[model samples]
Target chain A: EAGVAQSPRYKIIEKRQSVAFWCNPISGHATLYWYQQILGQGPKLLIQFQNNGVVDDSQLPKDRFSAERLKGVDSTLKIQPAKLEDSAVYLCASSLFIGGAVKQQFFGPGTRLTVL
Target chain B: DQQVKQNSPSLSVQEGRISILNCDYTNSMFDYFLWYKKYPAEGPTFLISISSIKDKNEDGRFTVFLNKSAKHLSLHIVPSQPGDSAVYFCAAGGGTGTASKLTFGTGTRLQVTL
Candidate 1:
């Protein structure tokens, strides 16, 4: 089975530039997530989507970051006016939903964004 | 207030030895725990998991032991191989309303050398 897929394994941009990362989850997976992993730190949840509907995005910085899973299969995460602090790896993950039980999330290689 | 923590940043062990990595969580709401291994430039892959109801779970040469009362968990790799050298992350899940979101520790980098 193909694992979660992401585009542009590496990205570099200048501050104030807008950058977008794409993710295509595993087929038949119903839950998708976006996470930011800074150097030396664990990945932090940026947002979660349950079949095109947002399940949680409390940690997301809505002012500069936004994500959507319109078709619920592939998703995109965008950052506008990117700052140097935004330099980090953007990871996408997906998991199968069995009834109401949540399962292990499979992750993509991730896009390493470096804002200069 | 970090919810999950891996105090040791790195560990080195000779091949064929046992490698132990520790993790602690402050949130008692966590009902499920997991361990993930990651290689450089690759995303983390699930290694093993344990539910709150179980104190220990083993897969192949990897064993995870949980101590609920102490909010501590450890991952043990026996007869460690060089391929086992990677960053290991401890993650906790399940809370009152958190759903499937996982809280992860900083990670422990283990180097298994021959």
Candidate 2:
């Protein structure tokens, strides 16, 4: 089976620019997630969606970051007015929902964003 | 405040030896812990996991030990191979009133030499 898929594996933009990343999760998976991983650090959860509805986004930077999952399959994460500090890898993950919540998650090749 | 922490930035082990990576979490609510191995330019792959109710879980060459009272866990790989060299991350999850959200630690880079 194919794993989660992400677009534009690498991206470079100037500070204050807007950038977007896309993700297509595994078929039949009911949960999708977006995470940010700074160099030398683990991926941090940014937002999570279950069937086209947000399940959690408490760590999302509401002032600049936004995400959406359409039809419970594909997702997009956007960062407007990106800052140099935002230079990190954006990872997308998906998992099959079981017994009310997802267990193990399968990750995608992340999009590495660099803000100059 | 980081909830999960992998204190060792890197570790080196000779092939055929054992490689142990450690992790500690500050939150007591975490009941499920997982370890992921990642290679350069690729996404992390789940290695092994242990639930709080269990103290140890093993899969072939990899074993995970959980010490719930201390809020600590460790991943052990036996007969480490060259292909096992990668950054290993430990993640924790489980809480109330929320979907299971993972909190990961900074990774520990493992180097296995032949």
Candidate 3:
């Protein structure tokens, strides 16, 4: 099976500008997630989607960030008025489900966003 | 607040030696622990994992030890190879059954030299 797919491996934008990143998870996976990883840090969960519905997004920066998983298949994460602090790698991942005999998460090559 | 932590920012080990990476978590509710290895420019790959009920889990050359009483865990790589050099991250998964969400720690970069 093909791994999770993401578009535009890298992006550079000016501060206060808007940008978007896209991800297509592995087929048959029921859970999708978006995470941010700053340099030298671990990936931080931004939002999680269990199919077409959201499971958790408590850690998401609501004021500036928003995400959507249309048709419960692919997902897109957007950041408006990007801040310098938002410069980090955005990763998208998927799992078969939150509850099951399998619990491993498969990750895609992340989109590295650099805000000037 | 940082709930999970990997205090060591980096570690260097000689090839064929033992490489031990440590992690500590502050939450007792975390019952499932996992280790992921990430190479540059690539996403992380799951290495090994252990449930709270067990103390050790092994996979090929990698082993993970969990100490529930201490809220600590360690990943040991035996006969460490240069290819094993990568950033290692430890994650503590919450709850039982299906609701377990993972809280990850700051990664530790490991460098193995020949």
Candidate 4:
């Protein structure tokens, strides 16, 4: 079976530029999540989308960060006026959120963003 | 403040020996726990998990032990192999009775040497 897929595995941008990463989850997974993983640290949840609607985005920096999961299958995470601190690996994950507690989340090969 | 923490940044174990990686969480409400493994440039892959109601759960060579009172959990790999060397992350999930979004630990780099 195919795992979650993400685009532009690596990205480099200037501190003030805008960057976007895309993710395509496995078929039929309902819950989608975006996380930022800094070097030497764990991946922190930025936002979560259930179907086409958002569940949690409290950690998202709304002023510069944005994400949309249209049609409920694919998602895009955008960072505008990127700050140097935003340089990190952007990971996309999905899960079968329908049954039993929480199932294992399948992760995509993250997009490593480097903001210079 | 970090809710989940893996104090040891790395651990070295001899091949065929047992390797234990530990994690601690601050939230008492977390009801589900999981361990993930990741290689460089790849995303994390789920290893195993234990529900809050259970003190122990085992899967083949991997076992997860939870001590809810202490808010601590550990993952033990038996007869550790070089192929098992990777960064291990412990995550906690549970809330609102839905599939939980996870809160991950910093990660522990496990190296199995011959």
Q: Pick the candidate with the highest lDDT.
A: 1
lDDT of 4 by residue, A19-50 (tens): 99999999989889999999999999999998
Cα lDDT of all candidates, in order? 0.93, 0.92, 0.91, 0.93
Model 1 Cα lDDT, one tens digit per residue, B1-114 = 889999999999999999999999999899889899999999999999888889999999999999999999999999899999999999999672223889899999999998
Model 3's TM-score against the true structure: 0.97
Candidate 1 stretches with Cα past 4 Å from truth are B96-99
The deviation in Å at residue A52 for candidate 2 is 0.6
Superposed model 4: Cα runs more than 4 Å off: A98-100, B96-99
Best candidate, DockQ:
4
Runs of candidate 2 with Cα error greater than 4 angstroms are A99-101, B96-99
What lDDT does candidate 1 reach at residue A101? 72
The residue pairs in collision within model 3 are none
Candidate 4 colliding pairs, count: 0
Give the CAPRI rating of model 3.
Answer: medium
Candidate RMSDs in order: 1.3, 1.6, 1.4, 1.1
Which residue pairs collide in model 1, if any? Answer: none
lDDT of 1 by residue, A35-81 (tens): 99999999999999999999999999999999999888999999998
Candidate 4: residue B43 Cα off by (Å): 0.3
lDDT of 2 at B31: 83
